[model samples]
Target: MSINQSTIKKLYGLSAGRCNICKRVLIEEDVQIGEMAHVIAKNPGGPRGADNLANDNRYENLILLCSIDHTIVDSKPNDYPVSRLHQIKNDHEAYVFNRLSNNRGYFEDLLALNTLFKYIPILELRGMAMELPSRISNRFEAKDMFDNFIRGNPHLYPFKDRQLDRKWCSVISNMEILDCWILGSINGLNLITISDMYNSDPIPQPCYNIYVNDERGYMALNKRYLSPEQIDYVSTEVHRIVQDFIYSHTDLVHYIRNNFNEIEW
Candidate 1:
């Protein structure tokens, strides 16, 4: 028998209108690009077919995939075996549910949370922050790093949980401020200095001579510089912001770990 409308709805809805494999958007404003592929073929000679399995068109026996993935899986049934397809379906649905539901304790949630790190350079930033004056060769490069972080906002996994959402927002906000500060300094609208004190002495003490600029103060500096004490204060604040960003990422990872429970295979 052909798959019923209710089964089709469940397949598409549970997959969240995206391909189960590549996570590509399957449904758009004027197009439907999703294909429901059978895990066990209806005919015994078809890809992944079985001789005794009955009612092959049920939801449990199907997966939603993009046109490309559907073609790939059907063309290579040995690689995309029945067990593997079912696992993919379960994981994708769990990821969708974790994003949408408040309950939030799926094994897939940890994977989803870690996936965000791939889109941005948080680890690189943390390393640079630790090395401080020695790591930053050009001030504009630091600005570029922050720009990358801001651009990754659109690609991050959408967390529907209130606490997770709040932490993500705070991370984005702090990154924006740092980006603005670096850009302002580069343009000579504000001043930010990096230096190594005691360079003349045998032991060089690397230091970041940062200058604080409020939103309005971006134009106020106007190529002027700050005193040594003022620089030290601003540098401390900037370092704190970077620390907070790192802490936020850590907090998100811990939150996912605390709620994680293994899915039955």
Candidate 2:
């Protein structure tokens, strides 16, 4: 998903290259400015009114964050709570500078999201491949057979719908870290490749485990899988991820919104 370019400039101006959560002053050359955050999220209807300080992109609502903070708040708003957003307005006021309102969001004790980067691997792929039960000697046939089995029976596995309910802080934090890893583009191919018997698609390997991605179109497995427009798709993901580093907000839905229209044969 993507945001307007103006939003990026707004956030860059606000944070001045420093991460909002960690309060670490990132040297313009050193800190990688990641995203622009909404004090009150638009989804789940947090608040987007111009009259609301928390919702508007004023200095208070705006913050310059790293890739980690960007993903945490974007994916897990509750984890990066900020009560000060409510303090922005009363029932009638337009710009409540210091007083702050009473509304609620992710303003609890665990808002710092950078801590999770230490553990998350950045780019990891998890997929199933079909292989012989060890009795088959060719090895090649076993892998191919298992791959066929998985593709034929995707419904047999539940890996796609699994969820973990850890503390919001941990979950969001890791997600943020993962976003950076995908953006790192370090591997020979950038994203750590994973094999799949059933999932023929190659996902952009970010740090956090993909909990839910309704995205469609384009998965290029470098090793043994193929999908429609795989090369173009992988290239696009790399470009978009780079863009993500400059802007504070990246709406994946909006980013890949057009993919839905393609006819997948």
Candidate 3:
């Protein structure tokens, strides 16, 4: 089957407009330069033709390569085997994703928060809820409690959880905090509730649960490894990214304002 424009566009975006093999940046000027080479040749004797074609006409089987690298891979298909090509593709795509999400142009704190903002929406859209600490009241309450918890009990909030796997949960928690903070800032809301799902107290003892307002919502707190100072630093950085994005993409601002309310959060 012929490769569709959607497949091509998806491959380009997944590649971050760069060649997967040589990491050569593909821009409008070099539009005609890169080739999306198939990992498995379409020849009758090729390995895994059926499976490869099933995925090849799509993104997974295609690898973005410059003209030189494309010929090289195709020529030495034995040396650059399918599994090895897959590893290269996965690693390259991950590198691209990480770099764009965690841009270091801003200060470290701001850069992290910027990354959080950049990726959290994508994650949310993917059906992974931004899981926060047990019951963090409002945004202000979350900031105060989280600051104290992370600072006071760093040992408790290790990168690993009970399973000792899925260490990314800690990372997700931090991103969720940043996401909540951004939401509060954007909506001009004072109190941002992280998670209201509390059958019982989610946070246990040794970690203090200072009940500021039980009537307001459920309140539980533990550590997530971010300080108030970092929050303050990131606050300025958030403003910078938002302002820069708005200024550079005025059409986006217009689009957003045009359908501000119609957008489903």
The alpha-carbon lDDT assigned to residue 174 of candidate 2 equals: 34
Please list the C-alpha lDDT of all candidates, in the order they appear.
0.63, 0.36, 0.51
| Pairs with steric clashes in candidate 3 | 139-192
Of models 1 and 2, which has the larger TM-score? 1
Candidates 2 and 3, the one with greater lDDT: 3
TM-score ranking, best first: 1, 3, 2
lDDT of 2 by residue, 1-265 (tens): 4455676665554444456665455555765545556765544455332344433545445556567766765666555456643332121122221223211111211111112112222111101011101011111122233335447545432222122112222323333433343333223333332222124466564333211222332222333233445434544544443343223222322222232232121
Q: How far is candidate 2 from the true structure (C-alpha RMSD, Å)?
A: 24.1
- Per-candidate Cα RMSD to the true structure, in Å, reads 14.7, 24.1, 18.2
TM-score of each: 0.42, 0.23, 0.39
lDDT of 1 by residue, 1-265 (tens): 7889999999989998899999999978878989998898878888898898744888999999998999999999999999999999999999998776644433233444554445444445555444332223232243354355447644444554557667666666755555554554444332443221212233222323333334532223221345566556556756765677667657754654455443111
Our tally of clashes for model 2 stands at: 23
